[model samples]
Target: MNKNIILIGFMGTGKSSLGRRLARRLGYKFVDTDSAIEEITGKTVEQIFRKDGEIRFRSEEKLLVRKLSGQSGLVVATGGGMVLEQENVDLLKQNGVLICLRAEPEVILKRVKNKKRRPLLSRGDLLENIIKLTKERESAYEIADFSVDTSRLTFDEVLNQIRKFLQQEGYIK
Candidate 1:
């Protein structure tokens, strides 16, 4: 498929993992926006958040989103807040299908609690933060072309669901 497969979701929703698997399965290049930003800025995501702050990080993300939106044959795993801006969403959809991955708040906490990598979740109550952020992004996530809840689903199962949607949409055979 020439069109990009764009994965958007809250953190810890398996975007990177599933994007890599889908890219390999479809023989497409895989790009994680966070990693791309890190590469460009010469810093980890946490460093960017802690040092440069979210606004500066988002500026970098917006630039990368514009770049990725012009390409084809890609499986893009976008950062959790990338679509918060309408411009990012419009640009990404121009040459791609936006697939949102979702999970329960508790599931999200279970998935990311051990990792200190998530800057937004580093604040007070982890579960409360997840719920608040998820709620805040609900509208943006709703604009996705397709959505899959990864909660309680195996990796293979979630992948299959995504694949089935792509097939039905004629993105894959």
Candidate 2:
């Protein structure tokens, strides 16, 4: 696993969880950019959104992604909205293979229903919001080298699928 593997998707699509497992399976380092931001800022994502706002958080996110791009043998799990910025997508693609983990709006809502950590989903009508965001970001996500549907898959299943994809793509021996 020499190439960096970037995981992009909406919230609750298993980017962080699956990224960690995939990294372990591939003998690579796992870096969750959202966690990296929290570590650097000393704040939870919700708090960051409440205090510094989404713009500031996004700026930090971009920097973290840029930094991660220079690293090798790593699996990077990005925030749901990270790919909204073209620069971030370019940076990720430049240094690695970008894989988009996609899930239906209903599945995503169900998975994230009780997760208060996500600021964007704090309001009512989470399903609607998710659908709206999905529609808006679908094009950006489509730019990924591969896409994995995570709606009905377990973590291990998702990891296996990713492993197969990497092998098929010749990214792993």
Candidate 3:
């Protein structure tokens, strides 16, 4: 199997941006799983959450991950909560080098603040909700093959760091 580069992290951790940069640098295809889902389901993420709820969204997310797992030479940016599903994690591991982009809560809060698109954070208690979600999801994040702190790094910096890590870990030449 061709090893893929899979980016997993909380929302606002720069997965999509870094994934795009990394794919460009590495000459690979870029796949944003969230966008794929949006296209396939013909609904925005907020709409999916409001209409079908998180459980249904997650199920669809897992299905997309499974479908993408067989592809080669792709850099995939996954939804923040995608790794929470064990099946998704397993499928990602089978086909990719899982990289976790982590950031301080404050950094994430700053990056995501006033983001109207995110269904989960479209409430008053933004910081509190981020803290709660981070606490609940940290364990899943820890399962990543590599983790990078993106709190202070620019998008290019983070992409370079991931490239170095991949090379060191022999995922890339």
Best by lDDT: 1
Model 2, 1-173: lDDT tens digits are 38999999888999998888888888899999889999999999999999999999999998898888888999999998999999998888887999999999999988898888989878878888899889998898898888989999888888888888889999997
Compute the lDDT for candidate 2.
0.90
Give candidate 3 regions above 4 Å deviation: none
- For residues 13-99, what per-residue lDDT tens digits would candidate 1 score against the true structure? 999998999999889999999999999999999999999899999999999998988899999999999999999999999999999
**Every model's TM-score:** 0.98, 0.96, 0.96
| Cα error, candidate 1, residue 44 (Å) | 0.8
Report the Cα lDDT for candidate 1. 0.95
lDDT of 3 at 94: 87
Q: What is the lDDT of residue 134 in candidate 2?
A: 90
Q: Evaluate model 2: give its TM-score.
A: 0.96
Candidate lDDT (C-alpha), each: 0.95, 0.90, 0.90
Number of the top-ranking candidate, with TM-score as the measure? 1
Lowest-sum lDDT 10-residue window in model 3: 114-123
Q: What is the number of backbone collisions in each predicted candidate, taken in the order shown?
A: 0, 0, 0
